[model samples]
Target: MTPPRRFRAGRFLDAAAVHAAADANPRLRRFMRTVAGHGDAGEVRARRLLEHIIRHVIDDVGDLHLGNAVARLERIAVLRERIAGILDHVLEGGTLPEGVRVEALGESFDQLRTEMRELSRPRDGIVGDAPLRLAEDAAAYADSMLREFEAGGGAAGLHSEPAAAVNDAFRAMPADRQAAVRRAAALEPQALWRAVASETEGGKRAAVADLETRLGGRLTPDELSRLRTAVDDLGVARNRGLQVSQARLAEALARIVDPELRAVVAGGDVWLTQQLALHNPEALATLWRRFRDRGGRADDGPGFRAYLRHDMVTYGRGVLGEYTAAFSLSSIELFLKGPDANVKVAGTDLVGIGHDGWVWLVDDKSHRATSVGGVSALTDNLVANLRRDAADFRDAITRLQRDDPGFTPDPRILDAISRMEDAAAEIERINRRGSAATRPARISRALEERRLRLRVTSAAGEVREITQALRDLGLAVEPTGAPVPLPPTGGR
Candidate 1:
């Protein structure tokens, strides 16, 4: 084995401890039981799948680390993969035969041995035999399997895939030798995998002795089925873990960016981060740079420097809420942008709604609300446009109700719009009252107050009253409040 690097010893030891505990913990035993419930076929398949993942992580990602934590991670990952895969497969409604399981486990053990050897390899110039430690560990595991096997005494009972398969192969050769093969099989496969997974100093030896004493053999169909069920339960555990991982990773990654950007990006203020995550990590990095530049970091001019560095972590959570809202808004955008033939927009009041309500004003391409338009007459026009659009919507709904067999115009929506139109019409009427000779700029405050107190009799009533009050007072109603507030009665 290669001499250990100074940097690797602690982590390696840590990994070893975790792996060992995981291999023998009662939790894993229960986990196996849950997988067994999935059925033997599924458990076996899951084990195989887990083996594949471990190999990939270790060979690919772990190897990249030059036998540091990355390499250990590979082994750890594989072990977890084996455990989780068995659990998931059963839960997902898959199963494998006992023989199939034995072969799969054997392969996993072989790979683990190879990895442990590398892990034990000398980092500096020292030549240490890492495989020796693995072998010693394997022996303990073998003994445990033997004990477990002996307890069963070669009767058709549940054994790990490797143990069962090897026994089956031996039994087929000759009845007398069958018992010997079963005992040896228990020693070889189950114990080996257990040792590979086990990290406790002497746990592997104990496991092996247990196997030897158990005198285990091939599992019956029922045992296999139980194992499969147990494996299936693991899927639920895995999925739950995945959600937590995603949330944490998101939080961690978000920390690397500016606060406002994080807020806008995470709080759902903007679709930018959502878009960025969908692409590559590098793309997200680019957005981070741009966000900083916009905030004045690039030229050291007027950027949001203070916010970028500090406020993000502080305020990121609240912004995440905003981010969720933004996501919904985007969904709405798609409905508006797609198949215009099914929907259409026109007139002034349609444009009058606030930015949130002004669906069309929110840009699909840039993922931004219309920012260029000033917040004055243009806003008024937009509101007016919205009002008009509301009217149009009412008409459209009415038309659909009348023409389409399946159409049913929602009464609540229609009523809401009718109320809005009535308000607008009332404001217009009130404003017109200003033109009358007797009342022109002459209406008393008492009368104006009385008007404000009057019942919101219909949708048009409030707007009319406001318009009339403004014109009579010689004040610009449009520049003032466009939609007058409903009285204490809740409507004008």
Candidate 2:
């Protein structure tokens, strides 16, 4: 009886050759050194080094006779497989296999090195063209092998049961179906993951089933099971990441003192929660310092607004709802005459009357300050809103004075309107000439200044401005002071 074919460890030979080349070849040595020194969170450095070596070898092989090229391609395929095995061993903390000698494998690369050097030297034009064609064919073969290796997840993926299963399913698909799946994956990765993580088992099965159907029933029962297992693994990994992020965010919020602010943070919108959870705590702390440096005070409106602006600008709209909730204010409605009938318009993000009947209008602007275009749009919107509010306030005050005769309009309200008008004018000027020379720098500086002014004059500024206005009106007014018995938990 014929003996069963024994598995030969080609990786030992591949690893020896790579190490030997690093010592002999200046280019390869520099690459290996750079890769060794580079910092990577996991086995990424190993994977990149492996890919670079494979490409380098393919490039060096250059052109050969058809028969020689075919032989060279086969050798490269065997070498890649062995390299992957070596990577797995290294990543798993195993030393290189004993008795592997560089001299044994160095012969394999010697001919390719000679060919590469010869290609660089000027030769007969007709002869050079023939080598060039052969070189292209060899490169194509190398690329095909590389794609297959990557698709199988290199050496590390071979050990992962889920990844192995996924590869099995991927390989089972026809070439066209595989291409289609790749396209779909590229277009909507999040959607694909969501489908895999469907709440119901039936939904999950159906999604996979649909995928199989799209692939023209290419997936077998065993392959389908493997795909399901792989999907579950991916879902579990994603969920774990989200949980860790949420815990970090919760820990950060625990440091906050005010119950209202805590509530705001706790009651964050989905976008805000995701942002805060993933956001670096150290970065957040740095921003907090900047806020304090900019005259921000905790438990105050300006402080809260500054925090919101900084967080929003850095991390996007994830912190908007929670920070906006820091202010306890009433929403108001105003009536306006429309072309067809009377139209009721909602006031700004927050509106309220102080003890002395001084009205305050605040538009959070969380939406409009997230992007460059949003900044420009914000200026326009703020100007329009301020004008409308000022007109409405004037009309209402005039009506009150006519009706009571004893009613005295607060001069502070007029002053606030005037300040808003001036701010609006400045914003408009900036918007119009914002495209002049040094446009980006000018716009960026203007935006920063405006953001600072908004933080100072809006929430925090509103608190101080209203307080002073009440005192001027001969009404006893004091700050709300911090809320008592702060919640033990961050939020409800």
Candidate 3:
């Protein structure tokens, strides 16, 4: 545990805390569960795994301030208790996932851990990380898109820029309507009417009809028709102008060079599937197979990282959520980043080392919770993309089957596909009923978090009862219990 350089109290303590936190890393615990053995072999194997998990976490985080061998060995001793529970479960015939070659598992874990390593190596800054300006513009665009999505537009509308949509629609409006709106606006300005315009194409039309009603007595039927058309055209143009400002925000995200920021900025499932399919193809397939065998399927699909990002975005609206969190903590004397590798490692988002050297580690929820893409776009993206990617996985599997006819999907994966299809359909149903006014259910979270729990209980007498039942049914049932019946000894 290398302490923060300022508090050179001991790096060993920092190492201990890092080890403790790494011990909680899901990959390690999942591995421990996989290699559960009760006796000597189990403990030996468990210690080896503990060693790998701790070393790998520190390595990936690039923090070398770990405590000495004695501290690590002691940490191993503590981890053995977890192994003991795993062994007990295994010894009781707890079904485990099919074992992978340790090398494959290790390689996969290493790659995945790289994805989790905080990308603090700033590409944009002069000294270190250039402080990123809050993406308020992207947030505005997303808000307009969300309003559109709420007003009976499909989830696909999330990508349609309000400015772009209205611009195109206005160009298509009738010429008479075009001229009428120009004259009406020149005389009495529909600034307030335009204010309500960009919600969607449907919303703009509705606003036009309202304006026509307010001026009911003034025009001939043809004149009214032209007036209505002209007013909506101007309204849409106004909305487009506003969204043009908002649309500029999309660039802040697009211009981003960092992969992690881009991924979360890009939305959760989209990033997850792209990374899995592209960067971690080998790791993805391996983890997918491993997770399937262990009973993980569908949205619970192979990506643990995706699940974390979704929760982050769901809670934080994404723009400067951490800055808002940190603003409360900072003073002229406070450190900007976590300077301690052991207690407060590099990835620590907000580190408040008080003037007295009291290191306050604040886990900034906003890191994952908020997004520059706006809340509605981010939320629906997870819902939409999870369904899309699962279908993609199935299509790939089907294509593989075509190449090698004997290839059959793990039953769990098939089940996952079915559930994903059903959930996607359900979300569409919710969208159709116009219940999308409030947040439509997050399909990714539901899909990813849904678990099929199977419980097995061991009884003291079930084995004996089975043996007796077999005997009664006229079958030779051997009773091999303690005081084992000696085989056919002649009178001896």
* Among all candidates shown, the one with the greatest lDDT: 2
lDDT of 3 at 438: 38
- lDDT for each residue of candidate 1 in 1-492, tens digit (9 for 90 to 100): 222323322222223333344455677544544654575543333343233323323332233345454656577677668856765766676675334575775677677666666665534212244322212355564465445444643221211224333333333444434443344444454443453233222554465455444535454444333323322222222322322234654754565555544544443211123434434546455546766665444434213333333333323322332223234332232221121211113322111122333223221111112112222211233336436656667677778878987987655455545544554454445445765555333333322332211111111122222334333433221211222222232110
Which candidate comes out best when scored by TM-score? 2
Ranking by lDDT: 2, 3, 1
Total backbone collisions, model 3: 22
- Model 1 quality (TM-score): 0.21
Tell me how candidate 3 scores on lDDT.
Answer: 0.40
Write one digit per residue (lDDT tens) for candidate 2, span 346-378: 334433334443333433322222111222222
User: What TM-score does each of the candidates earn?
Assistant: 0.21, 0.22, 0.21
Query: What lDDT does candidate 3 reach at residue 6?
Result: 33
Where is model 3 poorest over a 10-residue stretch in terms of lDDT?
Answer: 452-461
Clashes of 2: 4
Model 1, global lDDT: 0.38
The global Cα lDDT (0 to 1) of model 2 is 0.43
Per-residue accuracy of model 3 over 85-168 as CA lDDT, tens digit each: 555656687643356344644554554344223222222211235433322365664454345434643222112223355546
TM-score of predicted structure 3: 0.21
Say which prediction, candidate 1 or candidate 2, comes out ahead on lDDT. Answer: 2
Runs in model 3 lying further than 4 Å from the true structure: 1-172, 175-210, 217-230, 238-319, 330-347, 355-357, 366-492
Better of 1 and 2 by TM-score: 2
Model 2: residues with Cα > 4 Å off, grouped in runs: 1-323, 326-373, 399-405, 422-452, 456-492
